[model samples]
Target: MRGLTAGYGPVRALDGVDVTAERGHITAVLGANGAGKTTLLRTISGLVRPTAGSVHVDGTDLTAAAAEKIARAGVAHVPEGRGVITELTVEENLRLGALLGSARKRTERTAEDVYTMFPALAERRRRDAHTLSGGERQMLVIGRALVSGPDVLLLDEPSLGLAPRIVSQIFGMLRDLVRETELAILLVEQNARSALSIADVGVVLGLGRVVATAPAAELAADDALRHAYLGF
Candidate 1:
């Protein structure tokens, strides 16, 4: 994105922000609460229109495209709070994800691959979504997003409200997914420490603008940065 700007009426959520998500890599966006991390993802996903500038994916401009168009273009967003339908069965939710790829022919590989990646989900496929635990719910949502077969996965706060062990397990799975599929991920996270631990690249946001952009290792090792922006 170049010179991107977005807002709610007069309240600017993003101000001339510039960022990138390279193919076959994970680019993490980290910031404090209300720092426009969610807005950035929403803008890229076409949920919120940009007031200025452009958003391109694989050289195609998407700043003004519809959300469905964006998803069909292979950008799947697993929004904050998981957004699972509590009334639906786990399998049903997975099926809904398949609908997002409605133009493509349905195949067993899609569901099987998601189940293989998230075995816990497969085990509870018959259960109602509301019955699952927090971590399980998170897995379900991510699995649902994967059913769409997106090239770029936009993950928002995947670790929120989960225990440390569960968080580690989920992130480990995500890292493995990245290595196995070579799928690009743009992760918006508040847990800077864990996010940086798995990120290939890190972009730090403050007051609706980028404060730092660097390799994960470099960002993790910077003491001043850890103290100032990351709250470590």
Candidate 2:
């Protein structure tokens, strides 16, 4: 994204934001509640249209593309809500993800891979999503997105309402996924410490724009910045 801008009526949510999520790496976006982190993901996923600038994936301009078009281009967004269909069974939800973009061809095989990645889901494949715990729900949503076979994965506030151990487990899996599968991840998180722990790059947003962009360790080591903006 370069000079990306998006808004809701009179209030601008994303103001001239510039960032990148490289393949085989994790780029974390950290900020306060209203710091435009979620908006950035929405814009890139086509949930919200940009008022200005450009969004490119694998060198293709997706600035004005529709949501489906963006997904077809290999961008999968797991929004803040954990987006599980409560009425659907675990396997059914996983199958839903396979319908999006290019993953449509290998739904069964991908579902098996997702079950392998998330053994808990495999154990409860016949249960409705509403019956799962918070951590299980989070895993289901992420596994759903993974089966889509996207090149870029955008995660929004994935650590919300989860235990520290569960968060660590999920983040650890993300690190392995990036290294083994070479997929790029753009993670928007409020858990600055955990996010930075696995990130290759970290981008800090304040108000509606970026205030800092640096390697993960550098950002984590910045005491002043952490105390002021990251609350760590």
Candidate 3:
């Protein structure tokens, strides 16, 4: 997304934000509450309308397109909450995501492929979604998104409220997925340190604007930046 600007009513949640997520890499978006992290992903995925700027996946312009159209373009978003259907079984929810992905080549990814990536979900494939634990639910949502075989995956607050061990495992798997599949991942996390630890690059947002964009290592090493914007 370049020069992306968006908000609700008159409030500008994002202001002149320019960002990129490359294939085979993970770009982490770090910020405090209300710093436009969620807005960035929403605008890119067409959930929130952009007041200005353009959103593109590859060379195709997706600026202000409908959410369904964007999804068909192979840009999948897994929002903050683990939003699996409580009434459906694990495999049922996974199939729904594939269907939501539109008429993409289904052979690109399968329920078995998702099961391989997340064995925990595979274990309870027939169980109700609500019966899974918090960490398991997080895995399920991510796996569901992956079933679409998206070129770019937008994740919002993936680590929110999870235990440290589970967070580590999930983040590590994301890193492996990017390396192996050459998938571009845009990760939004309030856990700045953890996000930077696994990210190839980091973008810091402050009050509806981008404060800095740098290599994750450089941002992690900057004490002043960490203290001021990251609050770590």
Best by TM-score: 3
lDDT of 2 by residue, 71-161 (tens): 9778889999888999999999998888874542222338788778778889999999999999999999999888888888999999999
Runs in model 3 deviating more than 4 A are 102-107
Model 1 lDDT-worst window of ten:
101-110
Ranking by TM-score: 3, 2, 1
TM-score of each: 0.95, 0.96, 0.97
Tell me the RMSD of model 3 versus the true structure: 1.3
User: Could you tell me how far off, in angstroms, the CA of residue 48 lies in candidate 3 after the best superposition?
Assistant: 0.7
Q: In candidate 3, what are the lDDT values of residues 1-232, reduced to their tens digit? A: 8898999998999999999889889999998999999999999988899989999888999996899999988899999998989999999999987887646433477889889888998999999999999999999999889888788899999999999999999999998898888688999999999999999999999998999999999999999999999988
Q: What is the lDDT of residue 3 in candidate 1?
A: 83
> Pairs clashing in candidate 1?
none
Q: Kindly indicate the candidate among 1 and 2 with the higher lDDT.
A: 2
Q: How does each model score on lDDT?
A: 0.89, 0.91, 0.91
What number of backbone clashes does candidate 2 have, counting pairs of residues 3 or more apart or in separate chains?
0
